[model samples]
Target: MYKKIRFLTILIFALIITAVLSTGFIYSISITNAPSKNSTSIVKDKGSENKAVNTKIKKLDSNSYNILVMGDSLARGTGDESNRGFANDFSSLWRAKAKKPIKVINIAVNGDVSSGLLNIVKDQQNLQYIQDSNMIFISIGGNEIKNFRSTDASSSVVQPNNEKAVQNSYLKNLENIFKLIRSKNQNSIVAFIGLYNPFGDDLTADKLELLNEWNYKTEDLVSSYDNAVYIPTYDLFKYNSQNYLAADNFHPNSAGYEAISKRIFESLKNFKN
Candidate 1:
């Protein structure tokens, strides 16, 4: 951007000088532009700063807490090649800030719908893991809308229509999740990362519209429950698609995960009873 501005400045100056000499005009124009030498210098400085941050992240952490991460692929770090999804990476950072160990159990499976969560709930063994948990982070619901268990799954796949029935079902089950958690640990704080638009620029206009509608409904549903805070991760990746998502464009990348983690962390105060 600075280089382009500098070029435009030089071009304008040249035209001004030419007009002055050719027309014998006394009028002169002096265009003040960003120094060209500083443009590359600034770029180099940015690279250095980014490198410093990267180096800082290599250090081991020291803080401790019992953290349980549940839900879907985002919780599992699906898009990350290094598998440093938001939950793992954020737990590491939290440990770095604390003085004890942070016990983290991530029981998140890919393509876990709401039904899958219920099935997990039915299994007493799985629920025992988080019985003494200090905190739980969840990112389910995408799969609840997506069903792939049938023989004609491809053609039979009927995602949520954002209608009253579908919306109510997700909301009631979400409430059930909270109620179940409350039953286990009355004071455990749960944070649900809200769904965002998953369509690439490839989505049709109608699809985008439906996505927005469903996202809004989901937000409301999550907010309706007590002890459950729904953090919106949609807008983070909606416009800046490339930087926020994985190659599949469905799951979030490292940056996207970080953004969501940071938002929930910022809202951590509300989780306190």
Candidate 2:
């Protein structure tokens, strides 16, 4: 009878261990999957910061629509061998899904910043494109944080103060950007692409926290616009960064871009409906 009881105890312990592990695994998935929908905020109070309420711009008056792509190397397809980044893939899918002809004007430079994007939008010709576009995609701010590293070259730790400063500057530039674009084209739907750390498994817990903070602020800003949306790529690339990254280990490769495109397209579809 003692042996029988001992065997039952071991079985119960094993079952408990399995249940705990299963719960943990499920919890991890929930955390990872939740960000995609959570990143998009449809609020309309961005005017407090810029004093310009996002005007509800009309959709393209014609069957054909323009899509203006702006921002850094990620926008320019730096890591993809085919040179067609996520935006390009997204454009193709969007054209097919929307059944509308799309004129894609991707002027994103390989090393552009939010300030650079502001300048580009400030240009008369680019402003014309903005004015004509039905949609715009801005992918910036990652460089602001990615360019800075910890005091130790080998460490992934980001100083809190530095991160704060970077985020502040990024948010300011983004505000100005929104103002400029809205000033030119009140009807264009602006989609701000959130950041994804390419460091993946190499990224420390502290660094990941900072990245999340960046994403949260980005979503907040995007939500403030009546005609804006935030597309979260952090979770998309979080677990697959190493495999999705290009040879340079910074930008997303073809597979990575495809994944990002699908997510952005999903958001666009929902927003349109």
Candidate 3:
């Protein structure tokens, strides 16, 4: 009887150990299958970060304005002491008035003529800018006129027939430039800043007539396009050259750029309306 009791006690002890071991194994599996709080927080943080990034991108896409500037020294703001040419000035003015973010992409090279600007527009990178821009500002033909004066120095002043030829060639290039720009971007407003007489009263009446004629023809050409307009600067600088021209007597000064920007800003407002 004592032997039997001992065997039973040993069997009971073994069963208790097995039960405890089984309970431990079940507890280990439950812990393994449960999600960690840290891991859950990390997943939530990642999703929140992605959402914030997407929201910022959408805001930029919907509210930002892009401007593209093309052509000569005027576009480059060559003589401004502040170095903010008319393009930058216009951008700032517009930004203030519109209260929106503005991005300006000025690719204008100093001394670049109409044909040169056309080539620039044809470039792939510039074409992409054109495609994405909301507005395009162009300042050209001044260099072409300079080139003519330098080459045709035999007469000391521009001859009528020679000026006509130059004007025709410039107009053709201008048309082609517009064609290329419109091909890339149909909705963007194209503003061509007209030539101003830096020489003031020193320029001969005949030459001045030719210059006026050039502006007239240019305005006429610009009017042909539904989305294009010519912003005349002749009158702006013609009577105020002493105050508006830079020390070089060629480019506009800071005040002159401000004037141009104001004019452009007004024109832009009108265009938008």
Candidates in order have lDDT scores of 0.67, 0.81, 0.82
lDDT tens digits by residue: candidate 3, 1-273: 999999999999999999999999999999998888676332235547654444331111336688889999999898899999898888887776556688777899998887888898888778878888888999998987754433345774366576777788889999998888889889888999999989766676666777788889999998898788889998899778889989999999999999998888888776661
For each candidate, what TM-score against the reference? 0.65, 0.72, 0.73
Error of 2 at 13 (Å): 99
Structure candidate 1, residue pairs in collision = 61-96, 62-96, 63-95, 63-98, 64-100, 64-101, 65-102
Q: Indicate the TM-score of model 3.
A: 0.73
**Which pairs clash in model 3?**
none
What would the C-alpha RMSD of candidate 1 be, to one decimal place? 23.1
Q: Which stretches of candidate 3 lie over 4 Å from their true place?
A: 1-63, 96-99, 147-159
Best by lDDT: 3
The number of residue pairs in model 2 that clash at the backbone is 1
- Model 3 lowest lDDT segment of ten: 53-62
Query: Model 1, 218-245: lDDT tens per residue?
Result: 6776676666677777778778778888
User: lDDT-based ranking, best first?
Assistant: 3, 2, 1
Cα RMSDs of all predictions? 23.1, 26.9, 10.0
| Poorest stretch of ten by lDDT in candidate 1 | 55-64
